[model samples]
Target chain A: MKRSDYQTEYKTDLPVMVTPLPKTGGSFRFTLKPWHGFVILMACLVSSGIAYAVTDKENASIFEVLVRWMPLLLKGFIFNLVISTCAMAIGTAVGAALGLGQISLHGWVRKASWLITQFFRNSPWLVLLFFAMFLLPFEITIGGLTIPLPDWVKAIIGLSLPVMANVSEIVRGAVLSLPSGQWEAAESLAYTRRQTLWLVILPQCVKRMLPPWMNLYAILTMATVLASIVGVSEVMTLTGQALSAEGGQTYWHRFTPLFYYCFSFTATRFHGGRYIWKRNILLSTKHCLRGP
Target chain B: MTTNEEMPMVSIKDVHKSFGDLEVLKGVSMDINRGEVICIIGPSGSGKSTLIRCINALNDIQQGSILVEGQEVNDPNLDKLELRKKVGMVFQQYNLFPHKTALENIMMAPIRVLKQDKKEVEETARALIKKVRLEGKEDNYPGELSGGQQQRVAIARSLAMKPDVILFDEVTAALDPETVNEVLLTIKELAEEGMTCILVTHEMAFAREVADHIYFTDRGVIVEHGPPTTFFDEAKDPRTKEFLSQIL
Candidate 1:
């Protein structure tokens, strides 16, 4: 029986979602677009609002609880931002080196790069963070003077390790994606291998690399909340402290998911806007962009 | 040794090339004198493109000696950049760097390899752009230009280095029928101005018009060669006759 026939028989007035019939060979039909992410975000927000309204307390509504704590939470969010920025800077430099090494002519250099990338990439993030916390020297004694390293510095190093691996993947992928014609053309111009890479190849790769780089940055930003576990006093840790208060205990379960959902949506939106803007600028600025 | 002093601009002797078991060039030899234009014509896989590429040392032959301006091409100690500065090549695909504008593409090799003053190179680049009839496309990227315009820009780029000889490999083969004449005209202008040129082309009419000498290759061997008048009209070899009949 046809789907429309069932609807007519049941006398139902539900809106029908008519998707295209699947082809014979493949039985998969899933196409999620960029706007779908926004739709999902909006749906989450609306549902959470309805849930808050349904579970209204006598003394404090959801609005009052959020108003009381958001300012305090923002202070810690700043620290989270700082940590993420520092880690990204460190990761980018290290990852670029590894990526270049991955394509190095020397076999040992390529192997070393592969080993380093795999070691960090395959390990669990939490374990790496713990190792950094325990294994790193807390203080250095040089010439009878003591220099102490902060806990967040350790956290940054841990976070950057994974980011370094991911960025190396992006760089390698971007470099490989360029057509071989660019290389041959540069070579015919009498460009050295290094010059060909720096001038001809890498410049073309910048456009291909930007979107993934920004997406990785957004993911790294979200992962910065893990800094709280190492006693870095970031937003998540501060939120935990706020919820441990006497009256805060009542809203703990609701507030945690609410904060996470909001933060995730913001990061995703930042990434989406940034990727589009970067691609547009790259397209427009072809004349101004020059290679080494 | 006196003959060595007046050596041809490019000399390829008994060049044999192979990729795995497939031999592409077998015992092919040619001498290209200064200010002479030679057009290599052949069917597919006849080593026409390979012969021109070998002159620039783009493809290394297994058994041969290729001398460009008396410099041994295969010599490890010889600076390749110096040799390439004297030999420029244009591809069939018009492989312009997408990131650079037409002017920048022309200016790149001169400023970078020659270490010439940027201002001087830019001036020469602009002049060459005008010579190629692409005066208004100075600021346009390769992606923005049509195939004919891009090929002209590529010709301008190869001309920028002031090379002794320029090799064109099926340059107009990728262009539309309407636009092929512009690129061909640009090359013809260069030829008339006494630039040493070796072109591997399928355009029989253009070859007849522009070529000072025509080398017809068949199966990695130059089976027939002469001035355009005699080569086209009074060809004697059976293979050349058969080849001409098939094409004409």
Candidate 2:
């Protein structure tokens, strides 16, 4: 087809450009609506009420046991957050470089990056966690300085491998999605290839990359639970320990751990959702800056 | 030694370009003089755009040479950034950086590539933006502007480099009919200001009015070329006549 005809067809098929509405003070506020908060409160109340009614009269009430164990379980949950944050930080830093390597001008770099990304991305997350746990040395000596590697540190490394691969894919996909006209325009203006990629191409890629990157973070946060199997004392492991300590016979007591898990997961997701929404507004405002 | 004015600004000699199996330009040759306005008119697949693109080394030719001033453009060791700095191009899509305001788009290359002082570049950018007759739209993003306004910004962007010659590759081909005149008027003003311009266009009337020389091509070769008055009015090749008849 003629280039003009192809361009016209592409332009018509483009999703109508949405001019963002004027930002009022309230619009930029937190995304968790009052209804969401109410629903969470109701679920907590109903679950606790059910647990309180069914427990043996002589034994401690499910609510009382929960109150006793809440501090320990909260500590474990905080550890989970730490694991997720560290894993995500390491993954993003390594993954961005790997992703750029996939598009590098050197054939060897591109092929090697592709192989590494595919190898880690396709392997099961649980397997990678085990591999990190078993294969990595327990301690390393660097110039007379010894650093001990803890199980939780190994779990962070294990979880980061897959996150890195997935993030690599996200970066590569976002870069490729941009129109070729951007590169050509930059080239005609005498910009070097490196200058074009940094200034013109990558800045545009950030908006396209943001949503998927956030999605990967959410998945990585959930995957941190898998570290429990590899011997990290994360929330799942602590919950299992707490259940055994409370005398594992009662049916009513079993629901307490489920309740704790649900609450923690929901809390993380709510915060994640809010964060993604706010970043979207900030990026769009930077790029679009709605004119009068 | 030849004087600077005597040397052609851009010279092409027996250039042959191909895309894998298909040959687009078959030994095409042309010489564009300093301060001259040359318009290339042809059917869709006639290699008009490809030829102009070759002048800036945007497309590589399989055979023969292209020179900007006295320097060979196709040399492997040639600094393309240097070549591109001297020869600017405006595309059909008006590929303005959507992330930047109109003023920033005009100012970017001079500041980033040329490493000019930001204040001086900003001054020149504002002047170029005003030259394109887009005064109040300086702060508007490319997405917020009409197609004509965006194209004008694109023109101003290329002009910011202060290139010795500029190539317009069917720049108005993608615009609405109402907006086409605004873009064409911008080009006409640039031509009147004696900017050496080589345009590939379908606008016959505008070509007749502004072009110092007109080249008609068909089947990957220039069928005829001459002063616009003779090229358009006098008897010429049957293909040129046929192409002109269909368009005009």
**After superposition, which runs of candidate 1 have C-alpha atoms over 4 Å from their true positions?**
A1-60, A140-147, A246-281, A284-292, B1-5
Error of 1 at B2 (Å): 11
lDDT of 2 by residue, A1-292 (tens): 4544644645653445433234656655556654665576567667766665675556676668878888887788778889988999999999999999999999999999999999999999999999999999999899999999999999999999999998899889988998998998999898998999998988788777776877777777778889889889988787788778876534333433454446545655565434553333244544454342
Instruction: For model 1, name the residue pairs that clash.
Output: none
For residue A271, give model 2's deviation from the true position in Å. 7.8
- For candidate 1, lDDT tens digit of each residue in A51-150? 6666644545556666787787877777777888898899999998898888888999999998999898788888888888889899878999998878
lDDT of 1 at B121: 94
- Per residue, candidate 2 scores C-alpha lDDT tens digits across B1-248 of 24388889898999999999999999999999998999999988999999988888888889989989888887889788988999999999999988788999998899999999999999998898889899999998887899999999999999999999999999999999999999999999999999999999999999999999999988899999999999988837888888777877
**Model 2 alpha-carbon miss at residue A191, Å:** 1.0
User: Model 2 reaches what TM-score against the true structure?
Assistant: 0.88
Residue-level lDDT tens digits of model 1 in B125-220: 999998999888999988789999999999999999898899999999999888999899999999999999999998889999999899999998
Query: What is the alpha-carbon lDDT of model 1 when measured against the actual structure?
Result: 0.82
Highest-scoring model, TM-score: 2
- Provide interface RMSD per model, one decimal: 2.1, 2.2
Q: What is the lDDT of residue B217 in candidate 2?
A: 87
